[model samples]
Target chain A: MNPATHRHPASYRDPAGFVFEEDGILYRQIHPRYQPSYEQLKQSGLYDRLVSEKLLIPHEEISQPNTADAFRIIRPQRIRPVIPPFCWTYNMLLDAAIATLRIQTIALQHGMILKDAHPSNIQFIGASPILIDTLSFETWIKTKPWIAYRQYCESFLLPLVIGHHGVPDSPKLLRAWPGGIPLETGRTMLPLRSKLSLHWLLHLHLHARQSRQGDTPKSSSTGFSSGQMKNLIHSLKLGTTRCHAGNKHSGWTNYEQQVSARGQYTSHKLAVIQKESAALSGIDTILDLGSNTGNYSNALRNISEKIIQLESDPQTANALYEKNKTAGDQNSLSLCLNVEDLLPAGCDHGLIPSLKSDLVLCLGLLHHLTYRNYIPLPDVLNLLAQLTNKYLWIEYIDPTDPLIREHFNPERVEQRLIDLETFEKQLETLFTTRYHTQLADSSRRLYLCSKK
Target chain B: MIHLLYLDPGNGSYLAQVIIASILGVVFYFRNLLYVVRDFFYRLLGKKDRSADS
Candidate 1:
């Protein structure tokens, strides 16, 4: 092993291999115990098929120093800015469930089976979901039932159904129970109508009852045929598709409809963004704060190499994600997160930065942070300074504006003394103003600033 | 005589999946068969609901 290589903390659970990083590059070390399955996976052409179909992350073998207890070292194409389970939207979780079924179906076609079905094994790159765990495949036995069946039900099936049934907090269930939500817990929490559905009755209610009884049939891998396994996979696919199709629209699903209410204001905002963004050079990554339904990010899509759309609302984030998926747009990634309180521990055990951006956009978000959230103006500026290494494009809304007055208390605003002059003075401590423009017929102003 | 059974949670879940999936497969086959038979009788009698054409 290389002396500088560091093993990721989350990679400790899997015995087949562990992911390690060496000098900014991520690599997976395959154990000798997995040599047979790894060879079979490649020789059977499963790896090539999955990669071509964009279902799995592609990797290339690398000759590293470690040789004693390792069969090989492979480095996969890193999926940047990984979105965690807590940050996933309802449709995003459903998309992940569908992707898991697709991976299992493809594996079965190549005479192999997925040994595990953990949600962490899958990550979204833009709108598409890709399997990140390369060692999850194993040769299928003749008569054995799928070992990952229960895990699939808990992690993918149950969560999708819960989210579709209007539990916006379903993603938190995964965080609370990493192994997966307990079947008995799911049975108790699901609505009465859910039990009447045949899919739920079989997968959740009966499964939970049987699990509590602890009844095991005799082990027989000999009688299970490939056709039977295919049937199981098909049933799971149908269940997941039904869940995804049944997702009900909630808060902020139609947020874009309100943007057209102020046609001139929106047009002017777009023009300023396009003109100011044109001045930036060598821009690689962009972080759009409060990216409600990703309208501005979609407008500036051609300006940056990649854009991470961060929205605090799950419904709004999912609306953007569905659009991205339909367009096959690989440049924009949407995540559900509260910008005011980002958890550093959640970012792969602090191995990666919680947020990275070459240019940060704070359009139509500062007033809410300062007035609604009560975060001080200087502190908000400082946070933005830490997030971006280069430029910051921000919008300032006057307290007297009709939109601002509706949401703020006049006495509170007067008490805070958060005027534009005070804000500009505070902003100067962290960023030097490059350009400023005032919107037409509004108390709104856009500023382009560089970190001081 | 009554027999008591004991098994770990893992094996128990696997057994449950096998049983449920097998039953579902058989039920689906029969359900499809019933639909096919109903359609056959309708065709033989040359009787179809007016709403079906719409």
Candidate 2:
């Protein structure tokens, strides 16, 4: 490995190639073993067709890496602020699964097979999820059923089934359980009647039973025709589409809808954001931390070229994703996870934590971190300073905000109330206040600050 | 050429897909054939089956 090249930790699972970045440009180095598959993918015209259909990310063959193990190094087009599978809502996950199956079917027609169906392989470039792993395809063998049948089940089918039963955290659950959701785990999660359904009986219930019994009495590889493969994929598609009941969450779903009904209090905040953002030019990226319902995200969309929203609630993120899809917003990236849980202990974060932006938005979130999360006010500002490259639009709600009383810690909440003057003094340590104001008829104060 | 290291396609699951797909393949094969036949008749009768291309 090159000293400057940092291999992505999650990329080690796939043997064909691994993604690494050198000087901030992402590259996928194809191993010598995967060269044949790569050649077949190109010569067979499968790569071209898939790229033309926009199902696969297009890449250019760059100069080979400076390593003996490397056969080819290609630069795949970048997807900003990659959102993981755990953050995806049921609908987004299902859509990704369907897209995977569709790509598999396409690959089959071109005499190749999609060897893996990991949900993380798909990223939302816009409203549609696209396959980012170019080396996921391999030449089809005569009777090789699917090298990744179990992976498809554990990663997509079972997760969707669990989500269909009104479990919103199924994707997160699957991610937590390691390689994929265990068959028995998925089997137990489904209701008894699932065994009656043909799709479930084959893919989940009996599949679980088959997995536990070790070697099936049948031969390891049996006669599986191409038609049978398509039929199996079709069945998986049927299972995915059967999941339609949307999951709803308690927090902030109706926040955007009520923005107009809240009258002066909300309008004043929006007016302030509009006036400030409208004056800015050539703003490259805007990061909205703690984006609940994209209420403020929608306000800042026109001024910035790209918007990255870090939303905690899956359902809220899912709702925002669906709204973006409906409106056809191509440059929006919504990541769903806890605001403070980005880099958990003993987990993957060597790359994810590097996300920052030119202008960072921290609207209406100070009290939640201070009063509710018990995070020191200075620490929050320090973190915000790290994320913000040039400008920051943050909010500090006064002690009288009625909403602050919901924290339930009467003593703790009162002690942590960061008043207007105190907030300015602390913020001055990191950012110079270019502008500041108290919203009319509301206990909220807004600040537009730039780094000193 | 197969790599020295490749993803472990669980033996049980690989065998199960063949075993189960063999049976369900017959079911869905005929099911797809029946749809084809139905679509053929619909086309002859000048009424387009909405699922003809599905």
Across A1-452, the per-residue lDDT of candidate 1 in tens digits comes to 56224877556656787788878888888888999999989999999999998989999998863667677899999887765665677777788888888998889888898888867778888888888889989998847778888888887788877876877657767767666788889767778888767777788878888778764455333246565677777777777787753444555677667667765888898888898888898788899989987777788888887898888777777777888888888999887777776423233223125566888999999887887777778778877887888999999888887876876877766666577898788889999999998887678899999988
Worst 10 residues of 1 chain A by lDDT: A343-352
User: For model 2, what is the alpha-carbon lDDT of residue A117?
Assistant: 75
TM-score of each: 0.89, 0.89
* Global fold similarity of model 2 (TM-score): 0.89
Sum up the clashes in candidate 2.
Answer: 0
Q: Where does model 2 exceed 4 Å of error?
A: A1-10, A64-68, A216-219, A343-354, A406-412, B1-12, B29-54
DockQ for each of the predicted structures, in order? 0.13, 0.29
Number of the predicted model whose TM-score against the real structure is largest: 1
lDDT of 2 by residue, A1-452 (tens): 46225776556667788888878888888898999999999999999999998899999998667777888889999987676677666667888888998999889988999887778788887578999989889988857688788888888889888877777657777557545688888788887876766887888887888878666445546677887787788888777788763557655787766555655877788788889878876688888888887768677878877788877777787777787888888877776656565433313333234457888888878887788877778888877877778889999888777666764587888777777788889999999988888887777889999976
Binned by DockQ into CAPRI classes (incorrect, acceptable, medium, high), candidate 2 is acceptable
**Candidate 1 C-alpha lDDT tens digits along B1-54:** 000011111442666767776877786788769878877888889978444575
Cα lDDT of model 2 overall?
Answer: 0.77
RMSD of 1: 6.0
